[model samples]
Target: MSVYTTVSRDSLQQWLQGYALGQLIDFQGIAAGITNTNYFVTTTHGRYVLTLFETLRLDELPYYLSLMSHLARHGVACPAPIADHSDRFASLLAGKPACLVSCLTGTDVSHPTAAQCRAVGEMLAQMHKAGATFPRKMHNPRGPHWWSLTAQQLYPQLPTDIAETLAEEIHFQDGHRFDHLPSGVIHADLFRDNVLLDGDSISGFIDFYYACNDILLYDIAIAVNDWARRDDGELDDELARAFLAGYQSERPLSQAERDCWPVMLRAAALRFWVSRLQDLYQPISGELTYTKDPAAFRQLLLAHRCRSEFWLG
Candidate 1:
């Protein structure tokens, strides 16, 4: 129940009148990611997801809604935002921005197999390809600027070793520039829970709220960091290889992408490390909030720092 705004059945039913969707059959608060309030919205028409944006404003939502529409139209397995009768993807609900999206099949895998990793990689590559044609662009709010700002805020609260690592990693990342890399729209937060699987096939890539323009390789790195991660927070070799193999099968990585592989990996790790720290130390009160352990990504970042060459080589 990461529900910040509770919607009663009567209010929700009233909202459904705006959409062509039949009467709201049932709806329940979803306990998934902490960023927004979600509900499993089932109507006489179909099963869909209802999201109430906790932080993002109404006008700031078109890019994401439009992007999802674009990706879905291009055959990407993701939620497609449902436009209301007025052809608007978003409207105010419970005094917050809200939208509905077609729900896809399948549950998220906790421990993905090599095949699932490969499927996820292939899906990501497809998303990247489709995103190339997406006209509009939005800044990655959780990009480097966010990393530095969050690190500064967490420094005083962090343990000695963690703080030192954060400082060193931030300094290291500041020196590297990704301006020359292939840039495109990316699903910046493609954690395991964000991807859904139906049997052996990928049903959808959900939670596109973190989507933005960035180095294409960084998106792959984000996916690999989560999909190919082992229990000890180290890269699982076989799974990593399968993932990259699947991605390259769709779109071969440019030499520049390969050359900067390690950087992206470490950068990806550091990003999550800082975010997890924020979630742990400054958690917001919610009906049901799920915060991950910050130490997992912290350990992974350290391991990545120790690597001299790409392990996948």
Candidate 2:
């Protein structure tokens, strides 16, 4: 949630008048993420998050907002988009597509414990089940198609070894198919910072901008890659096992999902590696922006390549 566009107090006050929400008490920019401009807005009624779409177009927003509403209504612990007096979820703010969502109660757990990982896993499974009936259909923007294009775009700027690894991985993934696996709406960017914890229990999952329809196992792979990793970029056995146990308690993984886990893990790693490289090389300037290290995910991809055993085992 970087601050790209600045919002003045008067401007925000005028905007809030359209909503039933009371006067804006205070607001501050959030600087933890790299995507959109986010602010923690406090009003006389309650707390909410005001997000200004950076890259996502206005026409492309309904799927995300509607998915959140669908999941929240089905008992998934996620933020609910707040509509204005006119019953519209999105509006123009600072000449950008903007919306308000209820602020969930909790803090992010950076270094989560095994129990916390379990909670996240269970919640993720529930989220998947809740979103299964959602009517919208949107492709995973950072899936294989995007990866191929982004890999080509970054190849000229990357080291030879990195470029070779990316090309080889992309080629392998292009040939492999998991069409038989179950698919649904997935929170593709459920890293630690995106989930909030009240104590050891997960309060809510945030940052649904990357949500899309994809293979369910791929979503699990993305979460496992981030949530079950040790300091050395190796998968933590205890955390991985606990997480899978929790997820299976709700929605069990099919035999195909288990058999294809290794490849899915590698695919998840590649997705982040390419994105981090793009952020590092072609960064967008903002009032408060943070570009994560591309080398971190590069090391992770190499580790996944070398490790043959599934972490969940």
Q: TM-scores, in order shown?
A: 0.92, 0.92
Question: What shift in Å separates residue 163 of candidate 2 from its native position after superposition?
Answer: 2.0
Q: What lDDT is reached at residue 14 by model 2?
A: 97
**Runs with alpha carbons beyond 4 Å of true place in candidate 2:** 282-289, 311-313
In model 2, what lDDT does residue 16 have?
96
Which of the numbered candidates is closest to the native, going by highest lDDT? 1
* Prediction-by-prediction clash tally: 1, 1
Alpha-carbon shift of residue 213 in model 1 (angstroms): 0.7
Worst 10 contiguous positions by lDDT, candidate 1:
282-291
Per-residue C-alpha lDDT of model 2 across residues 1-313, encoded as one tens digit per residue: 3688899999999999999999999999987667788899999999999999888788889999999988888989989999889888898999999999999999987678989999999999999999889999998878788889988888898889989988988998887888899999999998998899999877899989889999999999899898998877778888888788888889988788988888898899889988888888777675234677877777877887888667554
Q: Model 1, 23-67: lDDT tens per residue?
A: 888999987767799999999999999999988899999999999
